[model samples]
Target: MIQRPLYINKLLGFKDKQLIKIVTGIRRCGKSTLFEMYQEELLKKGVFKQQIQSINLEDPLYRDLINWEKLYDYINAHLVDDKMNYVFIDEIQNVADFQKAADGLFIKKNVDLYLTGSNSNIQSGQWATLLSGRYVQIHVFPLSFKEYSSALSSDNKFEKFKQYLENSSFPYVLNLNNDKKQIYDYLGGIYSTVVLKDVIANKKIRDINRLESVIKFMTDNIGNISSIKKISDTMVSEGLKILPVTIENYINALCDSYILYKANRYDVKGKRLLKTLDKYYLVDIGLRYYLLGNTKTDKGRILENIIYLELLRRGYNVYVGKNGDKEIDFIAESIDGTEYYQVAETVRDPLTLKRELSSLDLVRDHNPKFLLTQDFEPNTSHNGIKQINIIDWLLE
Candidate 1:
């Protein structure tokens, strides 16, 4: 079990706190592993084995806990009087009225609770209303480039790193030998489960076929601007009767499932986020390769997707830079008011380099405006902007 310091730090902060520790993300994205790490911490800290109870509601062994009362009874029976108790629940959403169970455990003076789910629709109003201001929600994503490199302990680091970029940062794929077919098959399984279980099973949807089509379209157009009107038009051309509102609803369902990511357009010239169209990025890149064969078409956009996820992992509020007529791949600003970045595939050609640099020039602010590329060369500085190799930046 490799330690994820980022998540560990968040978990450690909640030690013995009254607030419920909630970790959410797409399925198989290391939520359960983090819980295991936390359990180890408790044991090392001299927490009695009996004081800690971790239950996976998804397991068939817990079938009797189909409702809140059964769950409450099981947890209440384990509670020790006048002693601090640690409770960890995995896939808590599987239990009906999960909020009630969570609330019951939370109100007990001796219990410190932790819960995790693949989606946020676990308990609608009660979790927020009852536990309001008492719980902290931490989002966990797949491995970052730094985490990915650490996972691959190979002598040939660059080769392994390249494979990580191509394959993905999914935790399960780390054990599977770098076979392209097997990696994608694993990604497809995760995708299907998220779609069927999280989206279709939980949400109100009239047509599963149309929902799947919309998801395919979103995946194919990762990093490109999209609109409901455009989607409706495309479906009409394909002879599929899909309404614009229906397309919008399906998109919402996909987002709810944590399968698709949507980025709103920020007009740099206007200095605000625009409402017309938005770009979409998948939670993992390997899934795109699986669903839409290995095509060299749109490698630039795909590279953009990779950089986008990396920026997010680094704790930056990322957006597309729109400087008058020029467009920057990314405009990342950290919350601490420290860092900023602008990514592009390559700036080898003078005209292309100028186009990339031009976007940074418009933002006269003195923060870092880096131009990331695939080219291997010395990091260059032009007009107060720095240009470096994207791979090298990821390593740093």
Candidate 2:
């Protein structure tokens, strides 16, 4: 197993905090594997197996335990000893009123709680109203390029990079052979399930055709400024009658389901955030391509999407920086400092390099600014900003 140090480190830090350890992410992104890894760590530390009540709510064996009363009854019975008992519940949303049960579980000082879910409905709605700030949401993303390469165990870094970009960061892809059709089929199934179970069914959406048309438009227009009105108008042009309000709700539903992420624009000069014209990036590029076949022309935008997810994984508050009229690909900030980034397919053309660096140059701040590309040139650092190869940046 390729141990995900980042998530494990987080789990270690939040081991016995008062808050519930709520893990949220897209299905099959290794959240369950993360749970298993954490469990192994606990056991190795002398925590006995009997003390941990690991339950999969989706499992057929737990079909009878579909409500708070039954789940609470089983867990309450497991709280036998005075020692701190750890509870791990996978897909907790399968049980109705799960938040009540989870909240009730952590009330006892002898019990520590953890829950995983594929839908944001677990964090919002009833859960949010009940648990409120009593929980810490740790979003589990797909494998990063570095982690993917570790699973691949390939001698060639470039080959690993290419495979990651084309297939996706999902951990299961690591086990499959080098077959594009297999990768597509697996990702396609994941995409369909997330859309059907999480987005459409959970959100109670009735218009399937309109929702899919909007999905196609968003998938095609990755990294570009888009709004509900823009999506609605474009869909209308394609003979799909979708209202702007419907588009907004459906887009938000997809985002809540973890299929897409929206990065709002922040104005550097004005020192304020913009409400409109945010860019939506798919959770995984392979899933995006599986839904709407890959195109050679959109490779640059696809690279931008990859870098966005990486920044998110690194725990940065990332925003699309708006410098006057120019657009910076990403403005990432953390407690340590801030970093400005511009992503491009390559800087082979002088004009392209100039365009990529223009926004970063205009910013007067002394913070580190970087231009990431696929160029293999030795120009690692520019006048003030750093010009880095995308692959090198990902690995670093």
Candidate 3:
């Protein structure tokens, strides 16, 4: 099994804490695997096998314990007297009023509770209200480029990255050995589960065709600024009469399901967020190849999508920055301060290089600036801004 030290280290840090550890992400992004790995680590640290009680609600063996009361009683009955019990409940949302059971389990001084969910609702509404100030969420994402590269025997990172983009990054696809047909079928299964079970059924959305149209438009325009009215207008012109309100609902559902992520625009001069023309990025780029065939793609935008997700993995609040008329590709803010980024496929030409650097010039701030590209020359510095290869940056 591939080791995810990034997430595993996080779980280790929160081990045996009073807070309920909730791991969340899109479906098939390896939440279950992460739990299994962390459980193994617990055993390594002398956590006894008998003290660890794992119940996967999705498993048919636990079907009878679907109700919140029954689930609570079942786990409560298995508690090891006077010893710390590591209770892992997978897909806790399968039970109605699961927070009741979670709360019951949490109050026990000996129970170290861990839960996993595939949708955002696990932390919203009733769950959030009941578990307020009592939980710490550890969000899991699909394998990063570094993690993906670790699983391969070859040292050819550039080739592996190309394969990572074309083939799906949903973890299981790596086991298929880069077969096109197998990857297609695997990604299709994930798409259906996330759209049908997570988005449609969970949100009670009825129009599958219209929902798909919106998905296609958003997927095709990754890294581009868009709005509900613009999406509605475009679909109407294409003969699908979707209202802007319906489109907004669909977008919300998509985001809630973790199939898409929205990055709002930030006004650099005003130092505030803008409410218009927000950009959407897919959780996985291979899904884009699966939805739209492997035709010609915009390399620049694809690189931007990769960098955007990487910034998120590094724990930064990323946004598109508008400085007067020029738009900076990303403005990542964290406790350290604000950092600026500009991503492009290549800046080999002087004119292209100058155009990319101009936006950073407008920032007029002491915060670090970066220009990431695929062109691999010696890492150079234009003024104070650093220019590094995108692949090198990912490995870092």
Estimate every model's Cα lDDT from 0 to 1. Answer: 0.79, 0.87, 0.90
Error of 3 at 103 (Å): 0.6
172-257: candidate 2 lDDT, tens digit per residue: 98777868989988988888898898988888999888888888889888899998888878888888888788888998888888
At residue 77, give the lDDT of candidate 1.
96
What lDDT does model 3 reach?
0.90
RMSD of each: 2.2, 1.4, 1.2
Off by over 4 Å in 1: 123-130
Q: Please name the candidate that would achieve the greatest lDDT relative to the true structure.
A: 3
TM-score of each predicted structure versus truth: 0.92, 0.96, 0.97
- Count of clashing residue pairs in every prediction: 0, 0, 0
List candidate 2 segments past 4 Å from native.
Answer: 124-126
Sort order, TM-score high to low: 3, 2, 1
Identify the superior model by lDDT, candidate 1 or candidate 3.
Answer: 3
CA shift at 141, candidate 1, in angstroms?
Answer: 1.1
Quote model 1's TM-score. Answer: 0.92
